[model samples]
Target chain A: MSLSALVLHKNDNVATAVRPLESGDSIDVEVADCAVKIVLLQSIPFGHKFALQDIGWGERIIKYGETIGQATASIKKGEHVHIHNVEGLRGRGDRP
Target chain B: MNFMGYRRRNGSVGTRNHVLVFPTVICASSVADMISRAVPGTVSVTHPHGCGHLGEEKEHIIKTMVGFCSHPNVAGVLLVGLGCELITPELIAGEIAKTGQRFEILSIQAEGGTNATVEKGKTLAAGLLEEAAAAGREPVDISELIIGTNCGGSDTLSGLTANPAVGVAADILVTEGGTVLLTETPEMIGAEDALGRRAADEGIEKRIREITSATEVLAKRVGVDMRGSEPSPGNIEGGLTTLEEKSLGAVLKGGTSTVRQVVGYAEKPTEKGLIIMDGPAHDAVSNTGMIAAGAQVIVFTTGRGTPLGAPIAPVIKVSSNSGIYRRMKENIDINAGDILEGKDSIKTIGERIFREIIEVASGKATRAEVLGHNEFAIHSLGLSV
Candidate 1:
């Protein structure tokens, strides 16, 4: 399906869903010169983010050509990426 | 471009001619409030500090008080004190005298009691208000205006729509030789690299990194992850995922401009163009700092919706998306949400915001002003004792 989503930068690993997206919906997204299709693994609310490609555990999640956070768990392409799965690497007072 | 403004004897311009009821300390806030309420044409500004501060914090408080008293927006001031407070009216007066501001001081202790002080304050405030009413706005160059930009209650659309739209307006003002300010130091975290590239010189670039690092140090020292406080509950609901993401989006309100100077909290910029005021991200505290730093008007962008406004300056609210704009139409002045639906582009919405700024600067009361949102707060050091 043609997706209503935005990938802010070419180097970004995630795309923001412009509208509510449901599981099983396949989205075709183009970031820079590359075009790819990924099926959603979980329901995503409007304005939320989804991984454009598989992100390894503890790997940096890029958006706007910058690291927004690091993944807390392995994230599949098209899976929801939010607080539960992504943790900020900066200002991490919980860690020593 | 020019807007009609109140020309002050001190060689500054005022968008509003207000008689200010100023409280020197927390103990005098109620009396100050009472005085402003009793007098017509006066604005009340009260804060929770006036004692138990030392060194730089005390200096910041004094600077803020002097800044507000000498502010171009205020025509006259009635300074209220509790006599024993650490920040005495005499000290404030000594500073205001240099700025040539007309003021009167009423100490509740010296006046015998609250009732007596309030009575005397009413008389003093009334006189100032009467004098203020005679002043009229004259045509002034737009470059004389110092516009402060702040973003709060942001969402995903903030980066895409309202923030950048406001950025365009900021650039317009800057290109016209006017001043624009980018504040909320903590919000610059993830966008430091992008922002540093636009710094005017090596000193500014160094300051940018220092401020960003300082916020991280503060977050770590406090033991509460900034992400927890940032990307707040409303932000999560609106699709903001993390502090880095939030910072990246929030800093876009500055637009792409050459950073001219970096001033301390509540310190006015010496250089014009796009200056950075180092302060926290709290809406009220940040707004107060900007206003105290000589910002005559504030262009506040929000996606989650806030009715926050300064006690003095006009806060022009711009919504990042249509939902919040419709939900809080009474509070919001302009809607950039049309960009989401392709009804408007960022440049067009920015131009619209720029026009609204001119109208507000030329004496149009914002929705917040009409609704009476006179909020004020001081950024203080955490410890009270």
Candidate 2:
């Protein structure tokens, strides 16, 4: 199956969209050597990331096998992950 | 592996034999430029520095200037100064003299005026070029090479494609007993802990944390948000959402080699392997620091294409995506974007880059070098007083 998204690491809960994905579009993803099908909940632009599983609010968001930020709102599988829903955990003077 | 390179008098190998006409102050930049143009095989190094600098800032400018003069790539140097600048031509010449490299100094005030200074500089530069041209390339081992790695105009595909591919190339170089210098201290903020794990010792790991924290503090003190500047508008448009995301991908350019040491800006590494230099996130400044630190060649990964190059080193531009590669074919050298299109694997692209490095070291002209994009800048620690 052609991979529409890339899972950078085995532990990452999000995968980057290699191609632009639209609402109601079903795509095949290679997650941990397994082929999984996901239906897009919203339009995910190329290079943007999408949730591989349901992420609760305030939960850590992992990419590149590291914590990039945390979820600001509950995100469902196939939802686009970006600034609107995710908050960066570093470089903010307010954060440790 | 062996490549043909110029063996310098101090027993260092140089990929280019360039006679450098270095201006000590911004005021003398024009004189240096005119002199370099008058003399064949000479290059001029100019920047907006060398005056109104306080303690550490003054010291850093002087050190970086001297580093450039004594860089292995430079065969000889002609220092041009305004005579009244805080960083005198004598001081810069004194430092370069220690490296046993041939050098000459000219002061605009002492030489009467611009035309006279340029005339004197041209004569001096011509002599240096004659000497520089005498040096010849000989077969040198790959271990003698010091390669610098950097990512600029980066995007999502950067971490996914070009960066990791560069990592593989870095690993191969390390395996072959060569050195790779990874810079941009500010970009390593959130990924410090992960990078620290690769340090060769606890002391080195502690230094990594200290430098990253200090960089953050510096940004906060300036009343600027690092986040806004780091994920620049271009970065955001290219799909990077956070500084952490950019950092996580940026660190992959260092490969898995143990962090041997952390050096100051423009400071050369005492040991080999993957050494990190403390420098700003700006591409030109970071690239200049590494070149001054003795990197004979630089591999720059870019998702958004840029035509940045160094005056002394051959900068091999690697495009992260095929789109940018196709759009800017003249500027880009390697296309790691094939990995994203599933046309090529990371290992294959990595090996190709590794081979390209050897070829460039052996005198292959990179696109930037051929296009004359000699972008150079020095990082300053504090405001010039």
DockQ of 2: 0.37
**Chain B TM-score of every predicted model:** 0.96, 0.96
- Candidate 1: misplaced stretches above 4 Å? A1-3, A6-15, A22-44, A50-96, B225-242, B382-384
List TM-scores for all candidates, in order.
Answer: 0.86, 0.91
lDDT of 1 by residue, B1-385 (tens): 8998999888899888888898999999999999888886788976889888888788888998888888999899988999998898888999998988889988999999989999999999889988888899889999899998998887778886898799989999898888988999888876777678889998899999999888878887978556457767777777777777878777777766798999987898999899999999899888889989999999999989999998889999999889999999999999998876757667799999999998899899999999989889888856556
lDDT of each: 0.86, 0.87
TM-score of decoy 2: 0.91
Q: Where does model 1 sit among the CAPRI classes?
A: acceptable
Chain A accuracy as TM-score for every candidate: 0.87, 0.89
The most accurate candidate by TM-score is 2
lDDT of 2 by residue, B103-160 (tens): 9999999999999999988889988888887888999998999999999988678898
What residue pairs are clashing in model 2? none
